[model samples]
Target: MINLNEVLKTLNDDKQQEFINYLDKKNKRKDAKNIQLVKLLLIDKYSSQEISEKIYGKQNKVALHALRKRLFQSLIDFTANTCIKEENSLDVKLIKYIIAARSFLQKEQIEVGYQILDKAKIIATEYQLFSILNEIYHTKIQYVHQYKTLNLEETICNFKENQQQLIQEDNLNIAYANIRKSLNEYQQKKTIIDIKKLIENTLKTQNISDLSLLSFKSLYQLLQITTISSSQKFDYYNLTSFATETYKIVENHTSKNKQLYYHIEILYLISNIFFRNKKFHQSLKYLQLMNFYMNENKQKYLKDFSSKHDLLLALNYNYIEKQEEAIQLLENSINKKSSNVIQNLDIYLTLIVCYFQHKNLTKAQNLLSKLYHTDKWYLEKAGLVWTIKKNLIDILLQIDSGHINLVESRLKSFKRNYFKHLKDIHQENVIAYLKLVEIYYKNPEKASSKEFYNRVETSFNFIDNKKEDIFMMSFFAWLKAKMTKQDVYLVTLELINS
Candidate 1:
């Protein structure tokens, strides 16, 4: 019952109704109870035992199990059929072409079979569908002698070439998996690793230059890995160049109509990287391209990318002093229900930051309190980085609201929870920042003193302002504002511009 309900939740209302209609057509008996069970599950108004009683006049696990199984299988069939109808999928088209060619060959229709196979080979090669191309090459090699017009040597050479590519892609996937695993461990357990070095070594070993040969999906994954590494290092200057070059390769090689999803994703990624590097104008340019592509195919993926698009746009607007626009964008998105839990939490946190910058302490406090989930839940859903930001913001909010007791308790709790992890990850600066905040909290008057200002300067091992992360700078700006008695937003803008 739990598994079936989970699967059903993935479908929209229209698809759910289609699945019900499909079950009706497949039902041979007028007395079938599968539909009844699905309807009960859809409404979500009953426990398993209660549902069993409603459907069978009493709790009957055996019959309930059978009905659930039938419905689940029907859903699988319906989903597969629906996917086959997605004509934009190059892989599906290649599969269909290969199947047709095989059938024609089995019936001894030599010319038609060869023609279909040739067409499949062209597309499979164009898209770099190595595995599918391998199958096509295999069929041609098997029937090369039967069809004398076929070049056996050429078929074998293509097969070997595709085999090498398959091996290379497999190796790249393994490297990606290993890098992600290391990143997860670092994020979760605080296992120290140099993310930049790891990525560089992996790419060097893979010989991953000439991005044109990679498929859109492969390039997207590689870009994602690079993004993660750049994020950790707070250095997007090089990633900006790499991502832009990669996007150009994708743009020149792939058809936007067929690969619109990846196209939009790559554009968003480029925009985000540019934003992180504080190249606001360039970021907006890429975002415009992303928006234009999102409207393709009648806005098929608009809903999926809307939250992310608005979030990045708002971030840029906020940094560029368009606070009202940024705040409005975030406020509009905060209440919308999105399947992306991390993204939703980000929207909430960003809004809270905006309110805090505007010195609306009450609103910021209210928003922070609304994040009512447990720390474990947040860590699992949004990862340790987000959880840390939320904790830090909560402390800052309490500090500003003069909730001295709450601030003291939260500061102590944060240290107890994260001090060791931060140290392990070489983020001692965060711990140092918290110490400075605690210093100010305990003696607010001393924050403006030369001795305390020097203490702030000595506490941080400052990097180049251009290479510093924007979020870190924002937090530093808050301390600077306290020392100078200026508006935190103004200080933040100054630090970002610096």
Candidate 2:
């Protein structure tokens, strides 16, 4: 009853979109579970199974049942322009306010969301959705206030208290927990292997409804670990099969409003994976998609783009033989953000690599100069710092005349003075050993020497406790045979023949 027809008659197109959007934004709709089901029911009324399949991938029975039930409960009334639903819930009404807050928050506006969330906490207390209500604050709501203006230590401290409340409420939701863990590991400068395991575990959990997105991510994480290890323990085709299956799940759900940022994040990972594996074509495809989504969504989030994207975009373009585009993007990013050392060091190192690749020695040299001169956040990571320096030295020696002899002599002195730098087990981490191997190999004067193999052996020992491929074993075997004047090539040839 309740004059539902009159309500429908009064509302205009924009108002109708507000009703539709109640299920559009991810965090809001996810929090308002039943109302979201109602919106999906409305979309299902206008679309078919196949149309849904094409858009998302497949219809799920649970989702199908929920949609059908909600549609019947609403009792869709026909009109020339608009349709109306009866019996909206307290959850749906609250969801609308949350939506308003979220829109402001996204526009780098936070005060309005804070006021709206204040209203929500009372409704949340009344409705017993305290856990998710805490989530709204911990995840997005507070970030807007915290980042909207200048840094506020007290505001951040209070936000942390709220975050603690969120996690303590019911041990936190899986997605939120996984995100926290992943972020912590990233901040700690953990290896690809450790991060991959966490990402895989996140993807493996069957709780994820967004299959296409989650599967795409799982494959992306696995691909990263495989890249540095120089081995493929997982099958790409099988992962693609998982993707095809997950695409089926993609059909079950409508595109969430947050997919813009989430999609960019996934595609960035895919682009990196492709670039690393030398799959230039697939790399370009993902990169183009990333550019499309990120360009559209960039202004909505932070203004500065992910520096990794710019660097990787350059690398992708280079791989696809688009040198000009690659160099152009690299220059634009560096020029636009020359002063933003407030960001990660990976961006600086990546920029150095990008400039070097484009044959712009001046730009590359300038970046290297700034890297040391700039007091950027290097995550207090020594290995990362060394990676940047070694890469810069390698590039400088390659391009600058007479720098080669100087670099060689510097390295020779380094090998003697820093033989301790090479010999200390803790100092000789995997990356450190790899840098030494690269230095020895590049020096030409050092590669054939027995001492170089000793360094390589130390490197392998660093990998001893970790999972590794047959390639490492084969490499050491070849090295040992060479050191002992044995027929290493013939022995490896027989291994291949056998």
Q: Write the per-residue lDDT of candidate 2 for residues 354-456, one digit (tens) a residue.
A: 5554446677676666655321234344233344354435434342423455565545544543445334323344345446545644664575687877676
Give a tens-digit lDDT track for model 1, residues 1-498.
347776776676777899889888999999998889889998887889999999999989988888888777888888998877753477888888999988988888878988999999888777677899999998888777679977788778879978978877887788889988888776676577888888789878888776677767777878988898877656687787788888878768755456778888888899988888888999999999888988888787887889999999999999999999999999988766555778889999999999999989888988888899988788777778889999998988888888998988899899998999888777899999999999999999999999998999899989887767788899999999999999999999999997
Error of 1 at 113 (Å): 0.9
Using lDDT as the measure, the top candidate is: 1
Roughly what TM-score does model 2 have, to 2 decimal places? 0.43
For candidate 1, the lDDT comes to: 0.86
C-alpha lDDT of all candidate models, in order: 0.86, 0.48
Backbone clash count, each prediction separately: 0, 4
- Estimate the TM-score of every prediction: 0.91, 0.43
* C-alpha RMSD of each candidate structure in angstroms: 2.6, 22.1
